[model samples]
Target chain A: MVKCGLEIHQQLATKKLFCECNSELSEEILYKFERVLRPTQSELGEIDRAALEESLKKRRFIYEVTPNSCLVEADEEPPHELNREALEIALKIALMLHAKIVDEIHVMRKIVIDGSNTSGFQRTALIAVDGYIDTFFGRVRIPTICLEEEAARKIEEKDGGVVYRLDRLGIPLVEISTSPDMKNGEQVKEVAERI
Target chain B: MDTLRSKHIYKVKILSPNMEVEPGDLVEVKTKKGTFRGILMPKHEFSDENIIVLKLDNGYNIGLIPEEIKCIKKGIRRKKKSLYKFEKKDLPQISIISTGGTIASYIDYKTGAVHPALTAEDLIFSAPEIEEEANIKAFVLFNILSEDMNPLYWIQLARKIKDELKESHGVVIPHGTDTMSYTSAALSFMFSKLSGPVILVGAQRSSDRPSSDAYMNLISAVRVAKSDLGEVAVVMHATTSDDHCFIHRGTRVRKMHTSRRDAFKSVNSQPLGEVRGNKVIFYEGYRKVEEDVELYDKLDEKVSLIYYYPGMSGELMTRMLEGMDGAIIMGTGLGHISNEMIPLLKDFIRDGGVVGMSSQCIHGRVNLNVYSTGRKLKKIGVIPLEDMLPEVAYVKLMWLLGNFERDEVIKLLPQNLRGEISARRMIIW
Candidate 1:
C-alpha cells in the first residue's frame, strides 16, 4: 500500500512573526552585515545532524538589510511578542482541520544553520494537533499545525559567501503537516487541497 | 545604594535589599509579570529612573519598571579581571600595534559589552596559533575607536611603525575597519620606501562569537607579514570561507561594505596577492623595489573632501574652500559639478587654493574633457585625478600640501605616486 504525506509552508500576509515590521520583500537595500553560525548541542546532549552539516561547510552569511527591515529582522534587536494575527490565522487553520488548539503557546528554537535564519535557528510554536482531513480515497491524519518565522530569501550564492535579504526574514509562516494515511498520490493531492 | 550612585533613584529605592549587588552581578528579578533572570547591567545615561536594566542570558538588554519588580535576588558574582600570558618563540619577530577595534576585543560575559583586549598578550592568548609563526611584541598605541581617528593619529601611528620596524621583520596593526583604509592609505604615502610589510588587520565580528573573523584575519596577516612582501597592505578575508585572504594595496583599497568580512576591496586594481594556507601568491606585474625607506609624516589638516550632489549650494562649497590648503571634490560622473559652483571654484583656485577633481563613481577614471560641464570645471583650474579613489585623493592632497608648495601639489595630484592610480585598466577578477 502506498502511503503519502504533505508538509506545506504558507506565508501569511501580515507583519513579521516576532516583530512589528511589515511582512513585505524590499529591493532597495540600505546596508548589510555578515555573520558566522555554529551548531550548539540540543537538549538531548546531541547536535542536530542538519545543523552540524551546515556548520561543517564554514560559510559566511551576509545579510542585506533594507529600510523596511527593523532591528529584529537584522538580528540587532530582541524579538517582541508573537504576532497575534499570525497566531489567529494558525488557530483558524486548526479549526478548519478539526484539530485541538493548544491553550498555551511555547516558542521553540529549531536548529537550522544553513545561513538562512539569522539567529541560527527558526522560532516555531505548535498551535494545534491531532486533526483529520477526509478525501475520496480515505482520511489523512493531520499531526500538527505550527506558526514559525520565515528565513531570509537567498539573493545570490558565491564561492566565498551567500547573500540574503532580511526583508523576508521574520515573516510569519504557517506550517501544516499530515501523517502518511493517504493511499496514493491522487488522494494526497486531494487531502492537501482540502486542507 | 552606595553602588547605585546618583542614577535611577526610583529603581535604587526598590533595589535597596540588593544594594550590595553591583552592575556585573548575576541576579534574578522577581516581578508581577514573571521572574526575569540575568546580569544587572549598568543604567544607561538616558534611562528612566523608574526602570532597572538587565542583560539577559541571550545577550539582549531589557528594562523593567521598578514598580513591577517585586524583589531581587543576587546570584554568582562575576570575576573582576583575568590576565593573559605569552611565550616568545624563535620565529621571525612581528610587531603587533593594537588600536581599538573588534579584532582586538572580546565581549565581557558579565556585562555583555565589547571591551578591547588591549595587550599583545591578550591577542596572542586569543589566537594561540600565532605564537608558533612569529615572536610577537605588542604595543597598545591608543584605545580610541577607529571613528575618532584623525590626521594627527595617523602621523603618530606612522612614527610608531617607523620605530617598530627597527626591531621586527614586519609590523601588524590591528585596527577598526571603519577608518582602516584611510589609515592604511596615510601609511602607504608616509613611508616613501619600505623594508618590510606593514599590514592592517581587523575583524568583522568580535572574538567572543563563534563566527568571529579575528583568528583567521590575524593568522593571514601574520603569514603575510612573514612573507617576502615589503609594502603596506590590508589583509582580510578573500572569500566567505576561512580558506584564504587577499592582500590589498593600502592606497588602492576601500571599505566597500559596512559589515561584510570581505568588505575591503582593491578598487581599480587587483589585489597585490592572495595568502592561502602557508603560501603567498603575488599577482603579476606587482612592484618589487628595494630602497632605503623614507618617512613623510606631515599632513595638512586643512584639506577637505566634498562629495558633490545635485542642488548643492555654492555657499556650502565656498564655506568649505575658505582657509583650506587643498580640497578634493568627488564630483558626479566623469568629474562634473553643478555649473553654479564653477565661478566659486575658480575664485578659490585663483586665490591660491589647490583643488583636485576625482569621480564619485569609485571604479572609473575622472575625465574633465569628456563633458561640457567637466570642461568648464577644467577651464576653471580643476585638476582631474584619474582613477584615484576620493578618500585616497583626500589623504594624498593632505600629505602633498603638508610637504610641498601649492605649485607642487597641483602637479602631483594627478601623478601616479605609489600605485595610487593605474596607467591602464585591467579587467581580471
Candidate 2:
C-alpha cells in the first residue's frame, strides 16, 4: 500500500489571532511603517545560527491597514493573552479528530519567511496528538493538531497605488497533520476534507 | 557523584558569561509559585535573573524564585554539543542573487524549534519539484527584506546573474514581494535586452507551512528558467486557482495584494506568457533571446515615490522631491491631484527632479490633460506615464537616474521602455 501524510492549514475568521486588531485593508497606511525581525538565541547558549541567517535576509514588512482591518496584528503590539475564542475553536477541531488534549496550553514559535508576519515567526501550539479520524476507506491516525497565525493577504502589486494590505495576519489557523498512510491522491484529498 | 540527590535548595541564576556556577551546584531561590525542582542549563545569557532556570526531561525551560523553597537536585552534568554545523556544497555552476527575503528554512522535528535553513540542499528539498527542470547550482548573495532593498542590491544581483550566465542555464531569485516588483523592473532596465529568462519568484506563504506556495512558485520559476524564453521576467501565479501561472515582464509587473496567491500581475499590459501543466507557453509579442547578453547593473537608490491626495501638503511632496534624483507621483483620479500640490511638483521638476505621473486607479492610463489639475501638472514638467504602474515608474526612475541625467529621464519617462507604458489604453466597452 502507498503511504502518505498530510498537513492542512486553514485560516480563521478573526482579524487577528490572539489580539484585538481590526483585520482590514488600507494602502495609504501600509507605506508609512516598517519592521525588522531578530532571532532570539536558542536555549543551547549558542546563537540560533539559522535564525540569524534568516534574519539577514531581513524582509521589510509593509502592511496595508484599513480602518476596519486595523487591529492588534497590524499595530504589532504585544499579543493579548491568547484569544480564548481561537483556542476554543481549535480545541473543538482537535476533539472532532478524537485526539488527546494537553492540560496546559502553551504557545510556541513557528518561523516564517513571507512579509505577512511582522514578528518573522507565527506563534503556534500543539493542542492535540495521537488521535485518529475515520474515512470511508479506513481509519487514519492524526499525528498533530496545531493552531497558528495566518499570513497577510497579498494586495495587487501594480502602479498608481501598490496595495500591500495585512488585514489577515494573526487570524487563527487550524492545522492538522496526518500519518503517512494514504495510498493515493484521492485518499489525501479525502482526509483533507475530513480534517 | 550523585550530588543532585541532595534536597538542599541552591538558588542559582542563569547567566551567560563571566558568572560562575559549578556543574553540581544546587541553585534555587524562588519561583512564581511555592517552589520547583531541577539542575542548571549549561550556558546562559547575562540577562537571566533570580529565577533559577531548569531543564525538564521533555526539554522545556522553567524559572523558579528563591522563595519558592524549591530544592535543587543537581543531576549528572552532560557536556553540551557544539550546536553548530558548517558545511559547504560544490553547488552546480549556478548563481544565487538576493534582492531580499529568505528562500528556505529547516524546522527541528524533535523540539518544535524553527530556524532558517538556507543551504542549496534546503532550496532543493523545499521544492523537490525543481529537480525536474534544470540542474541548479545555488548560492545566497545577500539576505535583506524587500523594502530595505535599494539600487545596491539590484546592481549586486544583476552582477551575480551575469556571472552565472556562462556556466549555468538560467538564474533563480527567491525574493520578497514588497519590493520585488521594483527590483524586477530594475533588472528589466539593467538587462534592457537579455538572452535568457531571469525569473524572479517569491511566495506569500512561508516555505515551512504545508499550504505554502513556495514549491509551486519555485517549480514554475525553474520551468521559466529552463524555458527557451530569453528575457527578464517575474513568474508568479496567474490566479488564486493555482491552475495556471503567468510570466510578467520585469518592467511591467506589480504586487497587487498583501497576501493572496494571485498577488502578482502585469499592470496595464498582458503577461509575457502562461504556464499550464508542465508546459511553458509564450504568447506572441515576447522578445527572443540572442547569443550574446549585455548586462547593466547600475541603479540610483535615492529615487522616491510620492502620492498626490486631497489636502496633501506640497511640503511633504517637496521633501520627497527635493534632493531626490527622480520621483513617481501616484496621482489620484485620472492623473489629477490638488492644484495646491503643484508648486512643489514644479519646484521638484525645476530643481532637476524627474517627475512622472501615474494614475492611482491602477487600471487606467494617466491623462494629464483631462482635467485642469492634470493640465497644470503636465505644464509643471510632470511626464504622464501613460499606463505604467507606480512600481514600474519607481524602477524605471532608478534606472534612469543611473543611465541618464534628470532631463533625459523626463524625456524617457513617457517613451515606452520594455513595454512599461502601453501604446493604447485597452479600454473595455
Q: TM-score, each model?
A: 0.70, 0.62
Q: Give lDDT per model, in order.
A: 0.77, 0.65
What would the C-alpha RMSD of candidate 2 be, to one decimal place? 14.6
Per-residue lDDT tens digits for candidate 2, residues B277-317, read: 58899887877766767876667878888876777776777
For all candidates, what are the clash counts? 1, 53
Against the native complex, each candidate's DockQ, computed on alpha carbons, is 0.09, 0.04
Q: Once model 1 is optimally superposed onto the true structure by TM-score, how far is the C-alpha of residue B17 displaced, in angstroms? A: 3.1
lDDT score, candidate 2, position B225: 82
**In model 1, what is the error at residue A93, expressed in angstroms?**
15
Please give the TM-score that candidate 2 achieves against the real structure. Answer: 0.62
* TM-score of chain A as modeled in candidate 2: 0.77
lDDT of 2 by residue, A1-195 (tens): 788988888776654677776544444443334333333222222334455445435444455665545434543234677777778888999988988764344565555545566555667776766789887778889867888777776765443222346666777788888888787888888898766
For candidate 2, the per-residue lDDT at B121 reads 46
